[model samples]
Target: MPDAVMPREAAAALKGDAALPQKCLDCGQRIGWVELFFSLFLGLFKLTIGIISNSHALIASSLYSAQDFFSSIIVIISMKYQKRPPTEDYPYGFGKIEYVAAGALCLAVFLGAITLLIAATRVIFAGVTHPAHWVAFWAALVAFGANVMLYRYSECAGHRLGSPAILTTSEHVKGDAVSSILVAVAVLGTKAGIHHLDPLIAILEVAHIIFMLYHMLKQSVGGLMDAALPEEEQEQIRTLVTAVDGVEQITDLKTRAYGQSNEICVEIELDPSLALAATAPIRNAVKDTLLKGLVKPSTVKIYLAPAGEGRALASSRQQAVREALARYYLGHVKRHHLEITPSSVALRLTFYSQVLPGMRKQICAAVGTNIENNIEDGTVSVSEV
Candidate 1:
């Protein structure tokens, strides 16, 4: 029997710390809380300063901050639910909740962008009474600094935890940081006597938000739909599975993304002569290979099929017959060939025994009976060489 040994790294990643460790969950919660606090503080500060100074750009940035605050809450909730183990009612666990949270975040950002766009348009129609107050510029600068810090922290935390929600939130923070810079520039331009620059910058920020919304929405919807992994990754999985020693052919391979990880299902054909006990190690080998390779699926299901099942070709059936004969003959048989037809199979065998008066005929009859009993309808011819 082949050893069903799994690589240490593969074992750890598939069954150990890489699969949502409690420490990582705790870190995700802390990061979410930190983001929520900063988003709330900055949203209120920017909104207040934007209103006091009539800075449209700052108001738009405030709306983005508000969205970030909402997204932070959703992230925390997703992390809480995602920690639950698979149960009878939900066999796949709550990993998909992260995608739902992401979709909601995209919707919230879309609505905020539309609202900011309308408000900026209205402000553009109405003339500016005066230049934006210098205080609003300071607020924008502060928001920029805060968002930059949050982006750095959340990005690092996302990578460490391997949480898609955290990573998406980090991208949002990065966008907010860029928007803040634009807001600051608009405020300075307004103070420098460019009357329309503030509202124009607000419209520009709306455009950027919409752009980000497209990508976030695509990813969230893809996850919800159980989209397949990229073709390159699928091909890589095929290559690894085919490299296993006993795998004859891959009949089926499937993959889909689930939260931060992926799920894979593969069906492979093995030699018909292999005992049921022998297939266990082959399955384990395939699983270990995938986990050790770049695929690293969180869930792997392998189905084994014997050669010559269903639509298997004539050559496969011939090979199965040969294997069976080899087992039955032990070391006595020298050479053998098989011909399979729609209704019957014919096998020719050459043995290492000396010819005697009717020994060849008796040997042929015995082998024919054995082949017919073991395999399908078949005739065997034996000769001494």
Candidate 2:
């Protein structure tokens, strides 16, 4: 029931105004409700039929369906947490805690597969017999119809929500559908006096369960690991970061996925002339660009650095101190530059702004304060640019 919208579609769906948190909660709730109904139906029908047929496979399938129903209830409870405001203990928000639900579901499937296989093997070796249970046959047919209907609905909902949990549940339904078919055939075979077929089909159904479990496990693990964004997303992100205005070079770009969303971090080297005051706006612009066109995460971090000059020239005497300061502060006003000029004078030179050029004494006093506090003295002479 999670509405699986692509990044673009999700934005569009929220057009003109922000989408309500309630919308997301409702989607999760609706999906859970549908699954709950189907699960109950499957569980009750299978248990009834299983009892009448004395079929171990039918009984095991019923128990598994019951588990699925209960697990979905857990997911429903977790859905409310998904909407809870972040607290001190849970920082990254509760959105990703859904993955914990997925991991649990994976464990459930794994255990169910193991249990079913073990039970089937025991029944087969124990020479258990299945009766010609007409009631069980009809019940299975009804359950199969329900499975088909639930599978169709869940599949569509899963794709729309882009929820791995819903998708996994859909797949489980599909497996159950297949097993239902095998159950029908085996039941008929038993009724026809071909006694061995029921256990054989049960064993075959175990394979389907195993396949479903593996698929779910892969998805659950991938989310928990914070795996890197897909290749296409990475390429798009690189392009977006490099295209930002004033960015000289980008290094240490990294991205990771949290469920369907992504988080990105990058270190940028820019002209030192850029003002420090400009850092906030530029970082915001980059984040917006990525969110609009490339990757949108709960957060993005941008690290700023100098382009090329100041630090490398620190040991070289010939470099103009004024030019170094100019280049260093080009992109931002808050960043300072220290430069050394004219070799062998053993004197210091400094470059700074004289905001109140008329008050020579105040300017000189301010320059001294700026240097002593912001930079180490004796490295460069201070001068008005």
Residue 338 C-alpha lDDT in model 2: 35
User: Where does candidate 2 stray beyond 4 Å?
Assistant: 1-25, 107-112, 131-134, 191-194, 243-250, 259-261, 277-282, 294-298, 306-385
TM-score of each: 0.73, 0.67
RMSD after Cα superposition, model 1 = 13.3
Question: Best by lDDT, which number?
Answer: 1
- lDDT (CA) for every model shown? 0.74, 0.60
TM-score of 1: 0.73
lDDT of 2 by residue, 151-268 (tens): 8877766665455566667777776766676778777888888777777777776676666566656766776787777788778877887888877778667776654345677766
Q: Per-residue CA lDDT of candidate 1, range 192-308, in tens?
A: 889899999999988877887788779889989999988998998899999999999998887888775678888788876664456678888998787777523267777666667
